[model samples]
Target: MGAVSEPLIQWFELNRRLLPFRQEPSAYHIWVSEIMLQQTRVSAALPYYERFVAELPDPAALAACDPDKLRKLWQGLGYYSRVANMQKAAQIVCRQYGGQLPADYAALRALPGIGDYTAGAIASIAFGIPAPAVDGNVLRVFARLDNSSADITKPAAKREFTARVLEEMPKERPGPYNEALMELGALVCLPNGAPKCEVCPLAAQCKGRAAGRAEQLPVKTAKPEKTLVPVTAALITGPQGVLLQRRPSKGLLAGLWQPFAFEGTAMTQPELDAALRTIGLCVQWQAPLQSTRHVFTHRIWQISGFCGTAAGPAPEGCVWASRAELNGEYAVPSAFAGIMRQWRPE
Candidate 1:
């Protein structure tokens, strides 16, 4: 065992939070939690996790679930592709692995959306396998422990840190050891230059602390600037309720429903009328609603919204939904929450 094994595990056992997944550390539970936690916080993912597991408990159930229903279940949690890939993997598991996730690391890695870090997490935490789950947390811990100034965003640095993590992994207690490192990073050796070294169990052996660079060890490359996209959304409502259009099946917010919108600079009343006319609707524009912005990984949407009343039937490729139906049936993406909130019945 490496110097981090004993004390780190002890600290984790005493301080780890009581999460639902930890309470029932089955392979399915661990797998679901890991996927949800990718871009979401623990607190934010808790209700979604509980509801998802209750609806689809096992791989077979997930494989058989409806795609739209799955999207509804995963609503409000962005990155719909994660759940989509999970369903794909579940189908394969049902077909090939008898509806159970494979315990082997390679087999887990073969599944869609299960990268090295996620694969290692499920294998080690759920199956007691000796694998290193090197996520951002573990990377920060490793960089601080060795006082190395490596850019964690680089593949070579990740490979080197993964090797170091494997060397320190205790074979007999790999699950606990791996969990301990992750927990330590989340709670004590935090990111963004806010690590709490004074309370850290491995503070004694942390080289970054000795060198007074714990906050600066795990360097990362700067991301490119986001492209700005200006959008105008029409919240057209009539006897049927609100008008919503299903987005394209492949791009940002893929396969999700949103208000009828177009990307361009702000439009005048005549331009907006012409645009609505092109879509087979003669809408009388009411009051302007609040403007909002939503940020994605590669782009930013600066949205201006309008409330209007339509005079005719639903437009082509669009549907009118009641507020109740919108709440229960349609899986609208959160990107349009600002506009949707201002919607009113005719």
Candidate 2:
């Protein structure tokens, strides 16, 4: 271990969030929480984490969960593939490892969606192995601490940073050491030109802080432009309720339930009715709702919303969900939040 280990771990012990998963640091709990935390805030993931763990408490249970139900459980959380890959990994764990996530980093990394960072997090945090978990937060903190000018997006930079973290990681307390580094990054060493260096325990030793270049230390390649995709969400309501379509089993938003939606261009009234006709039903045009946007990693959905009435049997693989069903049974993604708000299902 190096000079940063003691103070860093001490700071984390004093200041870490009182999160539910941290209370019982088991392998399953850590695995699920870590996956949920990816590209998601801790506050946002709490309820979903609680619900998911309550329902699918272990690898075997997750392995045996129905696909639709699993999608529903992960409804609001975007990056649906994370949960899908988790299921695949869970199945592997159940079949091969007797429902236990392997303590070894290599074995854990081989699982679906288990990359180096995730594997290190699980191995160290859950199993007390000496490993380095370097995510964006860690990268920023490390860059500032060492004043490294490396481009953080490159694989070589990550490897070098991982090695540096390993140099400072306490062998006898790898879990807390890794957690401390992550906590410090998230809370004190913030990104986007807002690091709280005054309260940071590592401030005294931080090279970038001394050099007055903390924000500029971690260089990254420019992100690709997000293509704007116009889309329509049809809130077709009738005696039964609103029409919801099951997304295809594979692709963007795969296996999720959504209102009748068309991607590409916002549909005209005639086109909407034609769309309904193709599905063997016709809807009387009501009123167009407001437009909104849902941004993803590489794309932005410029959503045009509408509310209307329809009659007759649902198209194949679609369901007419009542307000109650929408609230209780269906797990609609947050992308449809704007249109659904117009319906006010709650």
Candidate 3:
């Protein structure tokens, strides 16, 4: 580490957030946090971290958690593959490693949820391996310091940064030194416009700063536009039961159960009734209950739902069940669940 790590560590000691993960942290806590922090910020990860740790607590506990229960814990956090893989990794820890996070970087990286970045973080932060956890923050630091015009998202850039940090790790107290470098990037190294060079420790060393190009050094490729998805739903009601439909095994709200619904251009009640009819249900007049929006990473849901009576027995399309099933048994999307909360389950 250069003259930067000493002061940065001092600054971090004085200014760090009093987060739950930082308190008496174990390897599991550190590992979980590293995973959660990937492509996410400390402020945003805070509440989710608290809820996750409180619910799972440890490797054994996490391994034992039901898949649905685990998904529920991560209901809103997209990129669900991360959470699902974390559970699989927990089981491995419990069974193979006796519930301890592996110390070797290679061994840890081999874990189900542990990627290269995550492995480096756990090995250095938790086990003191002098590894450099090159993430977006580290990449930004390198890009600005070197004034590299390369895309930070490229694999070669990440590998080069990681190797460089590993070589630069201080002989003594490497863990704090490495963590401080990352802290500087996340807290002070602004991603879009000019970084706060006045306060940055490496400001003098930054080539981008010297050239007055800190705002543009690390170039990024364009991001594609997000698409809009429209959906219609029925909150069908009769003596038999409310109509429930099982979502397909893939895409948004996969495997969840909800009322009869379809993706469409318009959310008109008659159109929704017709959609239900295709599945063999004839609908009676139903009053519209709510029109709302649910936003996902690449798609937006403009949903309108209504409550109505069925002509006779629930059509073959309907999963004959009471409201109890929707709330307890089905993993309804929170958007749907929100609507259900307002309904006085009759």
lDDT of each: 0.91, 0.89, 0.74
Clashes of each: 0, 0, 0
TM-score of each: 0.97, 0.97, 0.83
Misplaced by over 4 Å in model 2 are 344-346
Candidate 3 residue pairs in clash (backbone atoms < 3 Å): none
Q: TM-score order of candidates, best first?
A: 1, 2, 3
| lDDT digits (tens) for residues 1-346 of candidate 3 | 5565666678778766677766856788988888887757778888888999998989899999887777767665555667778988989888889888778988888988788778877788778887778877888887888888888777877777777776667757666766777788877887887588888877777788999889886786776677777777677767755666676756666665676666757667766767666767777764777777776677777777777777466554346666665545555666566555545545
RMSD of 1: 1.2
For model 3 the local lDDT of residue 268 reads 71
Off by over 4 Å in 1: none
Better of 2 and 3 by lDDT: 2
How does model 1 score by TM-score?
Answer: 0.97
Candidate 1, residues 1-346, lDDT tens digits: the string is 6678989999999999999999999999999999999999999999999999999999999999988889999999999999999999999999999999999999999999999999999999999999889999999999999999889999999999999999988999888998899899889999999999999999999999999999787899999999999898888888888988999889777788999888757776677779888867898888886899998888899998678887567877788999999998889988898889898664
Error of 3 at 6 (Å): 2.7
